[model samples]
Each structure stands twice: as C-alpha cells, then as structure tokens.
Target: MLWFKNAIVYQLNKDNLFDTQAITNAVNACPFVPCGNTDSMRSGWVSPFGESQDNPLVLDNNGQMLLRLKKEIKILPSSVIKQALAEKVTQQEQLFNRKLKKAEKLSLKDEVYIDLLPRAFSKYQFFWLWIDTVNKRVIVDSSSFKQAEDILALLRKEMGTLALTPYASDTPLEKTLTKWVKESLSFPPIILGDEIELKDAVEDSIVVKCKNQEINSQEIFVHIDSGKQISKLKLLDERGMSFILNRDYTLKRIKFDNAILDKNEDFLPEESNAKLEADFMLMISQLTDTFKSMQKIIEEIITV
Candidate 1:
C-alpha cells in the first residue's frame, strides 16, 4: 500500500553508524506533536505504520528501513491579509486625516498575519524515507530536491552525524541518454518506454515531450540529430516496474506492475498491519533489484 511515486536518492558514507536501534531511539526522542495556538508550522518524525502512538516509529524489513516525517503548515492567504491591512490602513488614515506611510502599513500587515495565523486552516504533508543499508543508499519520496533535503535535514539532525551525497557520474546523463536513444543501445533489464522529453542544449525553452510513441523511431531521431538532449525518459524494468528518469538522476512517477502487487493479495483487508508489512516487503524487493540494474547502467556509462 505504501509505494513511492517520486524518488530523490542519496548515497550514505561508509563511516556512518546506521543501526536500526540507534535510529529508532533518536527519532522517537522527537516525535510529532500538534501545532500550538500561535504556531504557524510544525514537523517531526512519526510512525510509518499510521499515526498510532503504539506503533513502532521505524520499520525494518530485511535491512531496509522505513520512516515517515509529518509536517503541518498554517494556511493564511496573502490576499486576505493584504485586504485586511488595506482596510486597517484606510481606517487609520481617515481618523488622522492623512495617508499612512509604507513602514506603518508594513507593521500593520505583520499584526494582521499574527492575528489570523491561529485561526487559519491547517494543511498536512507526509514524506516517506527509505534507507537501504546493504546498498548504502537513502531514497526519499518527494517530487522536489528541496523537499527531500528538508526531510533529510531532520533525519541528520536527529542522528547527529549522517553524511550523504547525491548519485552522480563523470559522464553527463543527458549525453548518455541521448546516445542510447539515437543509437538504439540496449541495457539488459532496462528498456525504453513510450514517454520521453527532449530539450535544446543552448535554448532550454525549446522542449519536446512524447507519449505513447516509439522512442527510437525516425521522428525521435530527428530531434536527437538536431542536438536536443534527453532531459527525461521513461524506462521499464524487466520485472514490470516503470519510472521516469530525469537528467539529474532522480526518478519520478514510479509504478509497480500488478504482477508484483498481487503477490500479497491473500492478506485480508481487515489485517491492516499484516497487509502493510507484506506490501512493504514486496515493494522493497522489487526496488532493490531495479536499483542494482540502474547501478550497472551507471557503471557502463562511466566506462564509455
């Protein structure tokens, strides 16, 4: 049930101590709590097995660890604050028979924001963190690098000396991907999917996105021949998993095939905990295999 849609990966340094017990203790020391009356935002670790306090804060399945961070933000629209401030400024100006200065209006706006924050609506977001100890990799479920960094920052703060680096290579991914498509090169267990995004190297604004079309056809080669780099490409694993590979080595819109999803179908809906554990185990198994294949591709590209 808990599948990652987007992934921003990081490599863990060999010197760090990443035991399950140590992480669970550190994370539990600062569990998530509801926002206070005057608080505009709050974020902390929470149990991956839903919000129940009784559930363990971390789940370890065959050396793969799962953790969740919960963030709550107060929503106060700027337009509303601006309108209220304008009304207040107008009222003050009318009483004094003079226009309000910029500084005075700015002070009033701050007061308005503080007064409305407690009453403002609340929005909640959850980010999933997966730590692959065997592979020394950390993968976060976030669409943006900044968002992933925020979650990782919290984890690093809790653990006290976590070190990580983004996946990288000496060879440019754009050039390698473009070459793969142009020459129709095949990497075992990884095949081109129907979706691709091409962009001009010099003029970034010129981009082309293709869907449900052959990636190696004459039409696609035309763009590649014209010097457009592959900015994004959809790739399918032999195990039926698919994801969009970005130029920066991040993945987006990952989907697992039903063949793998149905492996735990026997677990009843009422057995929520069992079902969750089973699903996580299955999902991680497939992802680990996929990552191995990707590592091979990176190694091959570097050698080339």
Candidate 2:
C-alpha cells in the first residue's frame, strides 16, 4: 500500500528492554516494574499471544537484527550550475587566444595598398598610370613602354629618378606620380610662424602679405633631402589668386556653397573668390607635401 510497506524493518534494544525499580528498607524490600513499552516489545519482538504473521523479522548478514534507514538525497544546489557555466566560458576564451597566437605566427609576410592620389603630383591631372615594382616597369595610359620610359626618364632628369619602379597594371596615375615625387624631389623646410594676409587676384594665384614684402605669384616648391623629390608646389599671384599643385602638380577642384557664404560679408563675389582660392591652395599644398612624405616612408617600409 505504501512505498516503504515491503521494506525491511528492525527494532532497537531496551536497556536490553526495561529496568525495574528497587526499594530497600530495614525490615521490608519492594520491587516495581517499568512503565513504558519495553525495548523487547519495540525491537520487533512478538508477544506470546500474537501470531508471527502480523510482524515479520528482518536479519543482517550475520543473522543479527539491525535498525538503520537509507535515503536518496540531493547534494548540489542551483548556484553550482552558474559556476559551471562561467568555467566553460573561461575555457572557450583560452582556446580562442591560443588560436589567435597560432595565426599570428603563420602571418610572416605583409602586403600593403598605397593611395597614389596625394603623393604623386599636387594637382590631379593624369588620370591613369600603373606601377610594377617587381618587373621595374611603369605604364602610362595609351602609352607604350618606350614612351612611358622616355617620359619617366625626362622627369627623372628634371627631378631625379625614384628607387621604386612602376608597374603596368597599376591604375590611377596619382599613385605613381606620388611615388616618383617623394623619391626624387627635395624641398626647403619653411615654417610660417605668423598668419599672413591672404589675397586673391583676377588671375588664379594667391598673394600673402608678410612683414617684409608681399609675396606675389610666388611659386613655392617643397622638397625633402637633397634629391629633387617635389611633393607639392603653390603658385601665389600678386592679386591674391592661388593655384594649388598636388603631388602630381595637377590643379585641385573645389566646391563653393552659396548658402554658407551668404551669411558672411567676406563671402561677397569678389572677396569669396579670392579668399577661397587662396585659402584652399595654401592649405592643399601643405597637406599634400605632409602626406606625401608620410606615404613615401610607409611605402619604403612595406616594400622592405
């Protein structure tokens, strides 16, 4: 009827059962019986009047009665599950780090892509060119090897030849032009400590008025070291009009927003035109040279 109905049962021992009370007197002696049920009765011992079918006796391996219970118990709590998950995550992270280390070890060679636009000529005019460093070949658009070679030779004669050669498949002439300029030209380091008044003229040129004299249509070519590596050049005119030359010496294009300029007096037709050209040309020339030098160093490192 119950889950434990057929389980083995055992009894415990009474003081070997029960103890009787004793009294001593000078002339009389008395004895008393224990009150509660005796251990013998509790120990699965049947009375002489009771039948054995009502109570069955259980024995140990030695035929000795035992009184012990066995039970199924839960030892782990719910928090242990969270701890296990955290340990699993730590193991996964360790495995990922090991894999990354292995990948780093395998990557011994590095290849880099260079942007030729800013490094070659300051103004962007040539649309296409290619450089094959491995083959030592440079190709210009629609030009044969001889023509390309001759052009490069002439450029080198004027501005020294670069250590790196150009490839035929290379596109975007700016890239090759930048490389050549960086390797060949040398520019004097000039630092403009104070802001000079910038003016623009009818002609496309810029004029900067300094303390000493107004530099008008002044052509400033930037070169590094002794070689003729020209990264950028700026032509400033007396009327304050300026022409910015990129690494490739191409004229740079600029966009003017009427909405923004309309709010300021300096944006008037004449003033805006002069200021815009002068400012952009001066800034673009400096930026081109700075970037060109950095590019050359990066290319040298990558190739090495």
Candidate 1, poorest ten consecutive residues by summed lDDT: 16-25
lDDT assessment of candidate 2:
0.28
- Those runs of model 2 whose alpha carbons end farther than 4 Å from true positions after fitting are 1-231, 237-240, 251-304
User: How many residue-pair clashes does candidate 1 contain?
Assistant: 0
The top-ranked prediction according to TM-score is 1
Against the hidden reference, what TM-scores do the models get? 0.94, 0.16
What is the TM-score of candidate 2?
0.16
lDDT of 2 by residue, 53-82 (tens): 442211111211111111112223335544
Show where candidate 1 strays beyond 4 Å. 94-97
Q: Distance (Å) between predicted and true CA of 251, model 2?
A: 4.7
Residue-by-residue lDDT tens digits, candidate 1, 1-304:
3888888889977787567776777788878988887889999988888898799888888778898899999998889998888888989999999989989888988888888888999999998989888788899999899989888878778788778988877788998888888878889789999999999989999999999989999999999889899999999997869999999999999998989878888877688778878888788888888888887886776566
Clashes of each: 0, 50
In lDDT terms, how accurate is model 1? 0.87
